[model samples]
Target: MAAFTATCCGRALKMVVFLARLVFQLLAVYAVVLLLVYVCQRSLQYFPDKNHPGDPKESAAPSMREVELRTEDGLTLNAWFAAPVKRDGKIVVMYHGNAGHIGHRAVKAQHFIDKGMGVLLVEYRGFGGNIGSPSEQGLYKDGRAALSFLEKQEYANAQLVIYGESIGSGVATQMAYEIQPRYLILEAPFSSAAAVAKKRYFFLPVDWLMKDRFDNIDKIGGIKTNLLIVHGDEDSVIPIELAQMLYEQANHPKEFITINGGHHNDLYDHHAGHVVTEWLEKQIAAEEPAVKPEE
Candidate 1:
């Protein structure tokens, strides 16, 4: 009986050692996964070249003039510019999301064009068949170049509306902070890239690992332009809560529209574009002085 008890204790000790080894082995494998995620994160984030319907610009009218943007970094980018249908109407400088190029948004541009507002479909470097690899600062340079082009065309800050979608929201916020466009609009925006990544990759240390930290929340408070935020409650990509959190950080003269059951890319199908443009048109009209009853 004593011998049998001793034998049982020895077996229990071996089982414990095996379980400990298994746990360590699992930990080692998980560490490797974390390292890979850190290294390949950028590739996972920016989708500059996405497969889409044949030529995003094919549906656009021939009147749309293709222009060149010379960045401060000395890179030349291709952009499409459509003059406002009515002279002196507000111009929308569109900074689109990460995936696909400006060409993917010709239909969206037509929304504003149909509204008689000029649309400058700003194409970031490495998108829309342009040159140079995209980075956080690179996109800012692209945004600046777009504004500079308009300035050269004699457009004032009051005549420009900076519009950002998805990742472009950071670019738009940054530009608004610097120049204070007449109005600033964001669609499906995130507080920061780090914040969104943390939600998606909770197991990984995304805050320390991410290189391009598009921190919009810290800068949105500094922008005093009339702001509008459009987000879909069912948005699965950036999450609607992120937009709400960003809106909370913004100053007054700001508005938010939560599209019910709206997903990340289908907001336009729900007439979000028409709704946004109409709101801005009203805001612009309201700010203008009323016609004199006698004069």
Candidate 2:
């Protein structure tokens, strides 16, 4: 009986040691993964194509002029200004998504130009062959620079609109909170970068691992400007629920447009321009007092 007991005790000790080693190995792997994610997190967040081979001039409208904006941090960014054909005194400062250069947005700019609204396609740092890397703060500065450039052109705050697309929504929300533009439009905005990351990487601790947490939900409530949010029902990249969460947090005088069967990149393709232009015209007309009848 004593020998049998001894054998059983030895077997239990071996099993415990083996289990402990396995646990340690797993922990080591997890730690390495976390480190890698931390080091290269921005790589996954920003996908910039420095050499945008396509010439924007070809597709640009006649009034579209290529301009360069200098951020407060001394970074010279690229931009394209598509002036209104009629100079309606309204301008849209567009902040694009993570991918693609400013030229890719020429069509969208043309849409606004056709509606008689000037469009400023602002490129973020590290995008469109611009200097400096793109971070949350860098993007905020870039947005501010774009707005300041337009302000210098004599566009009043009420005459300017801020448009945020995809990841650019965070930058737009921040700018809206600070400047309170007359109109703020967010397309397919996530509640927060961390929230979206958590949804995709539920197995990992994305909340703690993410460095550039563009927490738009936390900032949207502070934006008292007239807000318009556009999200597609079929968006797979940033879920519509995230945009809904943001809409719920926004202030009054806000509008939400749901595009049926629209994905992340095609919300505009689904007649979003019509919806947006109609709302913009209404807002502009509402601001303008009715002319009195001639006596």
Give a tens-digit lDDT track for model 1, residues 174-215. 999999887999999999999999998898888778989899
In candidate 1, which residue ranges exceed 4 Å CA deviation? 1-6, 50-57, 85-87
Q: Tell me each candidate's TM-score.
A: 0.91, 0.95
Clashing pairs in 1: none
Question: How many clashes (backbone N, Cα, C below 3 Å) per candidate?
Answer: 0, 0
Model 1, residue 215: distance off in Å is 1.3
Clashing pairs in 2: none
Angstrom error of the Cα, residue 137, model 2: value is 0.5
User: What do the candidate models score in CA lDDT, each in turn?
Assistant: 0.88, 0.87
Q: TM-score winner among the candidates?
A: 2
- What tens-digit string does per-residue lDDT give for candidate 2 at 96-195? 9879888877877777888778899889888888878889999999999998888787778877899999999999999998998889999899999999
Give the backbone clash total of model 1: 0
